[model samples]
Target: MTPFSQNMVSVSLWITVVMLFGSLCDGGKILVVPVEGSHWVNMDILIKALHGQGHSIDVIRTFNSWFVKENSTYYNSITILNTSGMDEEFVEDMLFKMIDYERGKGQMNAIQLYLHVFKAIHKTHEMICQLITNIFESEDILKTLKEKQYDLMLTDPAWGAGILLAHELKLPMVYNVRWTTTGEGHFDIAPSPMSYIPVTGSGNTDKMNFFQRVKNAFSYLLMDIQNSRFNLPLYQSFCDKYFHPRVHYYELLQGADIWLMRVDFVFEFPRPTMPNIIYIGGFQCKPAKALPQDLEDFMQSSGEHGVIIMSLGTFISDLPDDFTAEIAAAFAQLPQKVIWRYTGKRPSTLGNNTLLVDWMPQNDLLGHPKTKAFIAHGGTNGVQEALYHGIPVVGIPFFFDQYDNLLRLQERGGAKILSIATLNKNTLHAAIQEVINEPSYRLSMQRLSHLHRDKPIKPLDSALFWIEFVMRHKGAAHLRTESYKLPWYSYYSVDVAVTLFAVILIFILSIFLAVRYLCVKCCSRKRKTE
Candidate 1:
């Protein structure tokens, strides 16, 4: 071979090697469609971590989404999808009114509460669908997304809009649940055995008595009925118009490549979980950081008594002033200083010991050594943060999963549940005292915190690993369980139960017929002898 030919061959081989190396290093692009309000924490962390790992991320920001306001800057770029007349003030007003009515009127039962929440959510879904449909109709937004060629769609399935969006985009998707379970989704992910695993808002523990188990079963049925009657149809109407005319909404929701459940065994009961359902519970938690100077001064001034941090989270931050007054009165009696996150009128009885801020660094406050206990509204994030920081809680759960969250903490002996509806100065103070004074509460929290942090890999790493695994393997479809594909009866082994029942019946019938035949022959022989 000539010298020139040899040089050309070597250069071509080098070029091929470089191209392959570049392709191997390039992590696929990720698109995050965050859930409405506070649920975005899970997705936000995942997006930031993926970005850190060299994956390009684009976010779809809806006007009404709390996440867009909070974490949109983290992504490489964002596309603003407007939902007209669905602004933050409007949503805040609706939520505050609903929460106040439920708290004050107390006429709404469990079923009524469920129906009210369902209707409120359905209306939100309607608005979201309109926004999503507009995006699909628009050439610019659709063209941009297509150009990005997002490898995965990450969304919270609390709303069906995400499911519809995923289907339209024709991308592999991951469903993130900010809470332990998003109510009716357990059936789609895995068999949520009512024998041990509690349904959302059922309030039954794993060790339920007979009557309790029956009640739990009834609650599950009622939820299913509610979803089918109200929620599913509303979602289906929009999905049909947008995606396909005959789309099965539930099945579309079940098409997730992975489920990132923000839950851990320390807080939740023992139950069957699917392979694709990864528990990334403490992803929202961070190592203790220095508090703001004012916060630090306040904690230092609290001295030996310590400080209790109070917040109702974003959704219920607008508690009625009267309730706030009651809480302030209780705070006045305690030696421990209190910092309350209040967006309402300042409590009339606001004492010198209490400080009210519109917002405070919650997890950071809980991480403080001077922080004795947390008075939270029982949002999962709040409860998880408290548990993660080893701070015992005095939980005043208002609605939804709040009740269940506090119940689990109470079961774990790390918290006390006070009824928000019946909350007064006395009950508030007493519950606070019980939680603060009890050594067991603090001890329980410390133990759980240890378990939460003591993992082979950090939650962020676990999330990134699973995500990159999918990207590397072109959708980790193998990790997904066959449970999602199984029929409802087959998944729960109802068919097997029926088969066993039939066999038992046939065996009993055969024995009865044989005995009858023997008796008849004996009688006939006796008659002949006579």
Candidate 2:
């Protein structure tokens, strides 16, 4: 055989050998407790990927879950009965109230909105606590879960239920985390400086003026207050009731074996982070596939103008009638075709150029060659996907981290942000036009996409490796910091600072008293001489 042909055969044989070895390796059993909505969407992606890797995944969902179905090809699902704390109605109501307030059809100010979001957040956690309570209190459910003998517990710590489950089952915990039970995951585990690392919902960029920094500080304070008021009251007591005295719910979140953060520096401000955080941003994104025949026909018809995609993520579908009309009118004026994921009443102003569907293959549409700018609600998943596809955005953020996600894009010059209160046809149309026409927007996003895609290993592969690493080792405790076990005083060194201050104060006081004593003795001797 020729030398080159022999080498090729050798390489092919090695590849086949590796593939066979990989297939023979047994995958671990993973228990995934995911949050609903966009959170579940990404979690489901991860679950499928894990399943493909030969892992057994058991996902826990409530009976009234809106997104997570009971039946799936990827994983076995465990349904908790009559214990859904939050669902479709809860999120839908919050969206409409905010929408009404923005449209001046309801009573709400910044404070009111802030309060509403926190109270809603707290209630959501409370409901999750109830879910945990139901599980812990139920003998059959808890015992059955214990018997699963899962290798590791993978959960989104935003709800905190999974943390408790992990602890209860004595399983090593890994988090698919961005937000924790209290606030942003980074804030809980990393030394996030408020000066640069803008707090979630602060709407400030990394470069903050004094007032913006003040606002950032206030946002942190608000998070802390909300945590104390809600998280401690609901979770700490539950922990104290079931677990040991010092096992705080928040601490359990910080103590996770690994954190698969859903963002990267390309989409986030550079900040302090921990070793265990594996950034898997845009892991769910992939190249576009062949479109369904009708969608392909529509794409081809758009031709040079390309198409614009609009979606409010999973939580929103309906809008105020006038709001929908304004958006539809704006899309109508565009030269490009519009495909919007809207299930509400079709807007009267919707042009023939626009197509409204119950759902669209969002990642597929974003990755399409003929796609232009994206109109997004600024959810992390959508924003990340848009960035992955090198598409600029016109963002109308609604709640939670949505605005913050868009703010990152806007700061990077890849997106235009519009306030819901100020959004009209003129504004919407102008924003869309600017994003599409301005070459810089696309260029900036392309740069971000390049940076995001430049990684040695794909994000999904990296995530899978880390998750499997945890399972193989039985835990990733070596990578995890022990800082979570430290008390607040010790973590911040407040006690050390106080002790140092006291020592200095005592030394100064002793010196002062000695000087006064010498002065008094000198005066007495001088008086006696006189």
Candidate-wise lDDT, in order:
0.77, 0.88
Q: What is candidate 1's CA lDDT for residue 190?
A: 75
> How well does candidate 2 match the true structure in TM-score terms?
0.94
Q: What global local distance difference test value does model 1 have?
A: 0.77
Give per-residue lDDT, candidate 2, residue 218: 97
Off by over 4 Å in 2: 1-25, 244-246
Query: Which residue pairs show collisions in model 2?
Result: none
TM-score of each candidate?
0.86, 0.94
RMSD of model 2 against the true structure? 3.9
lDDT of 2 by residue, 215-235 (tens): 999989977987887676788
lDDT by residue for model 1 (1-530), tens = 99977977886665566445533336778877776566765577777777766788877776545545635555754555566424566556555555566576656665565566677666766766676777878888888877877788877887666667778778888777743213635556776777777777778888898888888899888777767786677767776776645777777777687777787888887787778888888888997899999989999999899999999887665666777788889899999999998888888988899999988989899999999999988888889999999999988766677888888888988998887666889999998999888899999999989988876556666676667666666676787766656777997799999999999999999999999999999999999999
The residue pairs in collision within model 1 are none
The per-residue C-alpha lDDT of model 1 at residue 61 equals 71
